[model samples]
Target: MPIALLLAVPLTRAPYILSFSFLLLIYLTLAESYDVLSGYSGYMNLGHVCFFAIGGYTLAVIVTKFSSFPLALAFLLSPLSATIFALFISYPLFRLRGAYFAIASLALGILLYYIFVNPSFDWLAGGMRGLMINTSENRSIISYYLAVSIAIIAILTHYSIPKTKLGLALLAIKDNEDVAKTFGIAPYRAKTQALVISASIAGFAGGVYVYGIGYVNPLTVLNTEILLTPVVMTLIGGTGIYSGPLTGAVLLMIIQEVLWVKITHFHLFIYGLILVLVGLFMPGGLLRQTQIQKIITRLKG
Candidate 1:
């Protein structure tokens, strides 16, 4: 029913609604993807958005370099590039754990942001100028549908993971890595798998995002705020649960819209305050609240 409503959203012909829905779905995709790795595996990777930036830039570069290249192929390459990068860095990144791992991951994002924004790389990445695509009039509609499909896929992936062998391995590692290793679970293998999958989904979603906007820039795709959206959303919604990111994305987006319109001057301050409040009062996330849990249980039943 929710998906049906999303499908019907384009029919409303309201640009603002479409735009809002698109951004919501994109963040939803990112949040779910981030949860798959950090939430499940207990690895708090701050650089996950690097995959997203890579994806957007991958398509941007392909289109800009080979103007005649098939857009579909370019779109597909987005996730591939991200997955490859994940595979390349998985081993080294997995070697570190906890705060060390997180800081390293964040450094990766900052490095990429500077690389893309630096004028020295202008010949390839367009530097601070950014890259633009020639999109059709119906580009927004197509992007919306792509985002919806990808978001659904991310949701399903997050849901199915906990039921799979990989999911159990991750849970075990999350609880106690040394004990998981004793049980024949390869920590690196499982974590790498989660990271790759997470990167791929975020990459594809990033592609859809840049395509929809018809342009890409370092700040737009690789900014600190953009990188943190998924983490914040997942934390707000409830990590380690499939429904958490969805709930977070919806609730945060609504709050953001309201704040943007009603309190433009201090919206960021208000937003940060709200996040702090959530952290202090609902540390386990909004969904983990006993009342909310009861509601969910009744609905499930």
Candidate 2:
């Protein structure tokens, strides 16, 4: 990958490469989080951005109010706050199923948006005005490094979880709840673990995002588009494997960069059309098709 980047640098230039790399890191982290709940646990969390927003807001408030703290401490607080928020809601949320769960999550996100917009909480989040980070050219480079590190950490964490008992239990529950219970796997506990971990990763990604963008508004955090990017990336790339999100993010980023410039207003229309076509023909996603064929060949052998 480094060698490929080195060769492409002449054609792409350093700044564009750096910028896309930053976004790629963010996408990779967030996509892994999405897959833990949606792919592994079969829980559709449409409002996953709520956790991300919480992390961004938490970091913004902490860094803005207590600027004296070490940067590392501030970053930790962001995801910690998000994790706490996830834990607080997970019990009640775990009760809902299918479309109900998805709708409830979406509602929670909208509620957070309203709370952020409220005059009473205006001071907390700068209300609609948004929170701004103290910036420097050096800080930007530091943020890019932070994003890359977080992405790598998220990927490692994601893969490691599935090797643990809790991870296996979650997969068991995902396949069949009654069978998992017969084997003594607590379905609710496994689901909550996946949800909390996914939310925390997203929270960390949100922190990196705010640091990079240097601004945060409720609109930025609560936007449906922001929520869908990771989902679409996961589906397009394939969700059942660890590398799927990374592949999807890279592919989507390239397509967006290439076509977005040519069709600014109708870019989403084109994207949607492509998605429809992919769904009709690919079904199991681009990567899954290859995997399915390989499995069939092996079975025949």
Candidate 3:
């Protein structure tokens, strides 16, 4: 039903509607991607946005360098680059556990942000000025559908992971890494697999995002808010379940949109306060709240 509504959104021919829905799908894609590793495996990756940034910049560079290259082919390279980077970094990054891993990931994101914006890389990444691409007349609509496809893929990946060995390994590791290892679960391999999947989805989504906008810049792709939204949405929606990130993405996106439009002056403060309150009172997330659980039970009944 929701999918039907999303499919019909473009028919409205409303610019704001298309734009809003596109942004929502993008967030949903990222949140679900983040949930693949962090929600199931208990690895809080604060630098997950690094993949998104890399994906966007990669596509930007490709199009800039090979203007005649097929855009479809260039888009594919975005996720490939992100996946390669994730595979390369997973070894050392996965070695750290708990907050150490989280902080290191966060630092990694910051480091990449600076690297993309550095003057030395201008020939490739265009430095702080960013890269601009020639967008086609129908790019927005095409990108919107592409974003939808990636979001669907992310949702299916989240739904399907738990039924597989990797899923079991992730859940086991989340419960206790040492115990999981004793049970024959290769923690490093499982975690790496999850990260690689998450990175690829995020990369693809980021590519669609930049392609939609026809621009890529460090501030746009690697901003602090961009880095944090997926984490916040996944946590607030509830982890360890398929609906958690989806719930959080829809709820928070709506609330944030409303706040930004209505309470423009204090929206950020209000947003932060709401998150603080959720943390204090519903640390298990909205899905795990007793009231919500009862509601779900009633619906199922």
lDDT agreement with native, every candidate: 0.93, 0.80, 0.92
Off by over 4 Å in 3: none
lDDT, candidate 1, 1-301, per-residue tens: 9989999999999999999999999999999999999999889988989999999999989988899999999989999999999999998899998999999999999999999988899998999889998878899999999999999999999999999999999999999999999999999999999999999999999899999999999999888878788888988999999999999999999989988888749877887898789889987788889998999899999
Instruction: TM-score each candidate.
Output: 0.97, 0.89, 0.98
In the range 1-301, model 3's lDDT, one tens digit per residue, is 9888888888999999899999999999999999999989999999999999889988989988899999999999999999999999999999999999999999999999989888999999999989998889998899999988999999999999999999999999999999999989999999999999999999999899999989999999998878888988987899878899999999999999988888749877897898788879876789999999999999999
Error of 1 at 142 (Å): 0.7
lDDT of 2 by residue, 102-161 (tens): 899878878888999888987789989989988756665777778877887777777777
Against the true structure, candidate 2 has what lDDT? 0.80
Compared with the true structure, model 2 gives a TM-score of 0.89
Rank candidates by lDDT, best first: 1, 3, 2
Candidate 2's error at 66, in angstroms? 2.1
Candidate 2 Cα deviation (angstroms), residue 202 = 1.2
C-alpha lDDT of residue 269 in model 3? 87
lDDT of 2 at 276: 86
